[model samples]
Target chain A: MKKIFSILFVTLLLFSCQPDEIPPIGEATDYIPMLTGTWKLNKFEQIDADAESKSFPAFATVKDLTNVFPGHPYTDFSITFNPDGTFTADPGSSYMQMLTSGDWEVDDTEFPSAIILSSGSETQTIALNSLADVILGKVEFKEERKQADTGKIKIKYIYSLSKTSEL
Target chain B: MRQLIIISILIFGTFVLKAQDALPKFTVTPSEIDALTENVVIEFDVTGTAVEGLTDVYIWSWAPGLNPSEMLLCYDQGSPSWGSISDNAKLEPVAGQPNKFRLSLPKTVTRAGVEVTFNNVAELFGVGDTPGKIKEFGFLLRSQDGGSGGKQTPGDMKTSITLLPLEFEPSYFRTFPAKVSKNDVVTAYLNLSLIESSENQKLSVSDAFTATVSLLDENGTVLLTSEAFETTFTSEKEHAFSFIAEMLGAFPEGKSLDDVSKCQVVFSGKVYNQDESFETVSTKVFEFDFQDYE
Candidate 1:
């Protein structure tokens, strides 16, 4: 009888002490090397060409114009970042296209990493979060704008960017 | 007789163990995204069939990828100060802490979804020259039985900063009188109304949003300049400013608005904020054109 009681108690304790189930691993890492490719800019039909077009497509993605309003014209640009610090930007079905070649660098000083683009006459800095290469995920984009009459324009867009075949 | 006593004890122990498993859950009340010019207290109350197992409760900023350093500007000191249940109104800041604010969720949170109020006050002046943005606020409860403190929580259950639209309404105006003369004060008004999201999507609109207004003559020479005017007014909240050009100042002494060869206005602005654990929302820019004054 003593032996039977001890065994029963041990079994009950083991069953009650079971741990909670572990969640799936969903944390992401950075993608700094997946930017190497030759991209083809996509073109789109113009509805009202008379209206100052805000966004254009390139490198299989839509990116904004440097001179246009913040996030006004959703722009898609196909860009290839090589290990040598050179890049080729193509349009992704965007009629308004800008195929510019330049260098890019990342700033990790702050929490959300920033990428500064040195395209010919213009210089731009893009703040990025949830950065992953070759995988399709949502990322937050941040940029700063200085306007005349008003004050300043700080634009933020939450979009998905997946790694596609080189353009 | 010994056998019967052991059986009775076993039955009683089983019931007690089952009852412990039925402890009450915790819940946090939802709040409207209100605004204030100074520090505001966010109150959260924990009540209901209270449980005694929970060791501690914690509050965290639910927004992803925000700069921990920049967020420090929003708090009164550096951390969140807690008061007893009577009045959670007066909030003090925690000093030299990375997280913006924190709260204790002792075993007090009994019922599931316990309603709690947290005050988030707004201040007119910011830490430096910039007023940090208010992205979102939320809380997490932990069992504290040697488990992952707040990271083990399921989801972010709290209020967030709703992404707002750019305050860009582009329009131009020209002034002309029947009898035109020199040195006439020609003023133009520009209004920018900030926009926010409907679903409470997190957005940062403090120092991130800015406008640059300039006056250019036909020669492209800047007549007047104003850059980095850090300002934000909610949707339908209009901010008005006037610009005057001295026709005589541009050219010779006798030159007036009519005498001026050409005049024009250019306005540009953009908004930026952190998005996820370490990323930011795609940057946005807005531009407008005004009548050029000669």
Candidate 2:
């Protein structure tokens, strides 16, 4: 009985000495290397302040919220992130389509992380949920606007990007 | 030598023209004030040629640290002290006050720029209101259709003044059952206490005060939202009120309850006066991560 008691005490001491496991808040290390390269849109999710959820195809031609592609559906659409902190989106192979280019940066200080993209005077800050070498997921910040005729509305958007090429 | 002199003359002429064409210098007298009243008397002046073409001028006033969302919530609930702007008030010189004019803001102003400045300004707070102490006071000037080629300043043109010699007392809050386990039905409770600047003025509770809770997943998507709970303070001495938020059942879509990344709780409180007029006292947002729970 004395030996069993000693063993149990030692076991409790060892368990108490173990450090607490920290939940995966996503790796905070520099993501510039993993961020550079070509990526294709894989999934899109949008949720409004009212708790309404909407799912869209990889590249849809809808005009309401998922209108990344103006007139044409986003089939085989891809965005290339260069090493110099610049990015360009492929507007398909059509000549009439306009090319979209912007600047991108990652902010690791904020929880869920954030990636700010600026195209001209308009800028959008996207909250990163999970990020890896091959997979990237993000949720757009909430936007609130008041219509002159209607009242007020709040909207949020989320996106998933998959690595396509390293070059 | 002759060619050099000619070039010098042309350069000087161009420089003079540009100086004359620069945007007018706008000024606001008594730039800072110690106290705010229902009607604030403001002075405006234009010292350059651009003043003649000035179609309209407006003034925007508000307390610093108040965000746009909070201001809008206040406006929706009828609290006017967050900030406000004048609606294209006619800019005529003061009768006996010289450049000083009686300015009244139609609504609250949120952003800068002549066109964007007039929209979304909130009303001002006085001695009896919550957060009566002013830390940073902001004043802005705008001319209609104003720009480099027009009558107004080109960019974000505004001045911020610091109010001195004032004490501040913000609302205090506390929460219960600050932690929860996965797959457990939990009720989050919150307590909020009000503050009064003067002893003579009593703080009355409004029925519109509510508290709401939201559970978000790893993707910052809302997994569940609790119904907003209504609350009211019973007495002035015991100025604290409490509310409960209930989270029921397991999360949908077979997602593990432990995967919830964050929880947000928002408390919107309002107070009333002797005449039964109520205004939003405060709107506070609190965010908790999974680690905050036991």
Q: Which candidate wins on lDDT?
A: 2
> What's the residue-level lDDT of B214 in candidate 2?
73
Residues B78-135 of candidate 1 have per-residue lDDT tens digits of 4432221112211222344322223321212211234422223222112111222433
DockQ per candidate, 2 decimals? 0.02, 0.02
Model 2 interface CAPRI class: incorrect
Query: For this target, which candidate reaches the highest TM-score against the unseen true structure?
Result: 1
Angstrom error of the Cα, residue B74, model 2: value is 22
What digit string (tens of lDDT, one per residue) describes model 1 on residues A1-167?
99999999999999999997898977554455444443322221111110111111121112223212223222455566566777766543332223357887677533337766788777766666455433442233433222334332322223234445643
Candidate 2 residue A111 Cα shift, in angstroms, is 5.6
Model 2 share of native interface contacts:
0.00
| Regions of candidate 1 where Cα sits further than 4 Å from its true position | A15-30, A38-77, A90-99, A105-112, A116-124, A129-134, A137-140, A146-164, B1-121, B124-294
